[model samples]
Target: MISIPKDDPAAPDAFPAAPGAPSALETPASPSEVPKETSASLQMPEGLEFYAPNYICLTVFAVIFFPPLGLAAVYFSSKTTEANQNQDWEQAYINSGWTGWLDVFAILIGLAIIYVYTLYM
Candidate 1:
């Protein structure tokens, strides 16, 4: 209130207080007495979290450098994302992990092919 401009007609001198506002002393003194959760505290284990991570995009870009690896990564990423959407956490986790391996394998294979071509062809 002090920081607000006094000259500004839009600003009020003081904010209006709620009628029958409960005082701190009148409020729940004990932590246990105060109801903690306004809503359900625990969620029933359900629903899919199809969150697409940025690595999927990175792996797609890898296609330009290593076609096989990039393709594999994209495949794994798609599989995992689908599983996640289906509420299949295990499959999602497994596929997501494999996507990284695919990207690495693609880079290595691309390099290997280039090396072979340069030496032999």
Candidate 2:
């Protein structure tokens, strides 16, 4: 007679069974009966949607120079307004304005550095 130990690696059934077992593979809940996932829902705040144009412009400016950072700034700033509509428009405007200026400054600085390095080389 052959005996298989519970911890034996060769035994297919050696591992403990999952809780739901075979039922775990059954069909998922129907669309209507399923609890609606609220994760994807957009919950915008009160007044910020109006300044979408500013956000777009900032995003464009960012893309012209540092593509990744600009894209990230555009993404975060856009979401910032969406997450809180009641936020002050003046503040948003100032923040976007500075972000645009910084991107421009970085581009200029990079160009200057490259020009100087080429001259020295």
Candidate 3:
């Protein structure tokens, strides 16, 4: 069993009371007294845009039709999203292209398999 010292700092009376501070419920006397937005709170402008398509939906659709290539497409789609979040437009574009191609290939291959199975049997 663990034992705490009699003078443990974690005790409620161990520390002195803090100095008086203004309560959060109090409102500023004037608008100017309110805190202003700082550069740290600012966000990037909305003008910047990325044209790459993540192909996540198509990848999910492909998963229902084909598991192997569909899973690969999902990986590429996640990479595209990660690159986009990192602001690496080039990598995002490349990953998006790979995701799109994988999605298409998975769907096509699945259809081909179904067609061949129906024809043979």
Candidate 4:
């Protein structure tokens, strides 16, 4: 638990930096002078690895099952590939997850159709 002295109420400068340490107010005045990393410039750090999933399973499902959902899955899978190539790990992961869901849905729908057709016929 944090206990504040009665004499020192919470204020902007209530907490002081340790001696010789730079304060937030001491930051550079110009944004250009400050070094920053942007998303576009991001790269997969060395020693860490990410493997993009191939579209083989999704493609097979698309070929044998629902074409529409399969197509959308393939589309997102393509986007995942693009992101992987660009080293955009976040986007690649998102697109890959989306593709995975679409593939799952397509498989479920296909199985349902097969079951229904066999039962009705």
Candidate 5:
């Protein structure tokens, strides 16, 4: 344990304070004086909020089961949505359909390779 020396010139007073610190007795400003703007005022992109869930699920399934088909689906859906003026459910539908097709393609390719190897050996 350590003890402070009373006679030391470097020792601080009991009520020691900083030069720029606000006094404890002072009160904060009223609510009316504070800014009214809040983070909730900001708006997110419509496409992002609408299509994020479908896009995520399709992309995940594609990656795990069919890389090529997944790539194709991602490519086509992006294109169709870009071409149309009224996006509607275009993005979601395209993504799901394409992802499913690609998965099927991948499964077929795997089967073909297996068949060829079996025949040769």
Candidate 6:
């Protein structure tokens, strides 16, 4: 992409640089283009190699609403979070998959328990 300074005379609009503000096109960020707090490098946990956790609140709710549906999701979230904190993105991604299967397993087990309880009662 052809990047042109916003204040460049050749720019279609040719606007002047804002007094203390850096025009993105005109001045490349000297050191930190993006702020450290929001940067991806800072967010990742240690030991993380590839994956990242997402939609954790939804994952937690899935567990709460269907507790019988595997608390694997709970474990997954914790592990994922830990991995992220430790900067192990890839491992966190892998752990996320386990949560879904565990939930399904929990559901099946829960059903069996209910059936046996009903039969005995």
Per-residue lDDT tens digits of candidate 4, residues 10-121? 5345667867545787877787766665545666565137846746576668647887888888888889888876777788889888888888888889889999999999
Report lDDT (Cα) of residue 89, candidate 3: 79
Q: What is the TM-score of each candidate against the true structure?
A: 0.47, 0.37, 0.61, 0.58, 0.33, 0.41
> How many clashes does each candidate structure show, in the order listed?
0, 3, 0, 0, 1, 15
Residues forming the 10-long window of minimal summed lDDT in candidate 4: 39-48
Per-residue lDDT for 1-121 in model 3, tens only? Answer: 8766778777665444445533567778888776666433442554137646887789998898899999999998889877766667799899999999889999999999999999999
- Which candidate comes out best when scored by lDDT? 3
Model 5 C-alpha lDDT per residue in residues 1-121, reported as the tens digit of each score? 7778999888877755555544677544776554444323433466445542235455555555556666675675565454332344556566546655665666566567678889998
lDDT of 1 at 82: 74
Clashes of 1: 0
Cα RMSD for candidate 4?
Answer: 11.1
Q: Where does the lowest 10-residue lDDT sum fall in candidate 5?
A: 34-43
- For candidate 2, what is the lDDT? 0.56
Higher TM-score: candidate 4 or 6?
Answer: 4
Clashing pairs in 4: none
Task: List CA RMSD, all candidates.
Answer: 12.8, 16.7, 14.7, 11.1, 15.4, 9.2
TM-score ranking from best candidate downward: 3, 4, 1, 6, 2, 5
lDDT of 5: 0.56
TM-score, candidate number 4: 0.58
Residue 22: error of model 2 in Å? 46
Stretches > 4 Å off in candidate 2 = 1-49, 52-87
Q: Candidate 6 — what's its lDDT?
A: 0.63
Q: Give a tens-digit lDDT track for model 6, residues 34-71.
A: 43343354654543455564546655555654574446
TM-score head-to-head 1 vs 2, winner:
1
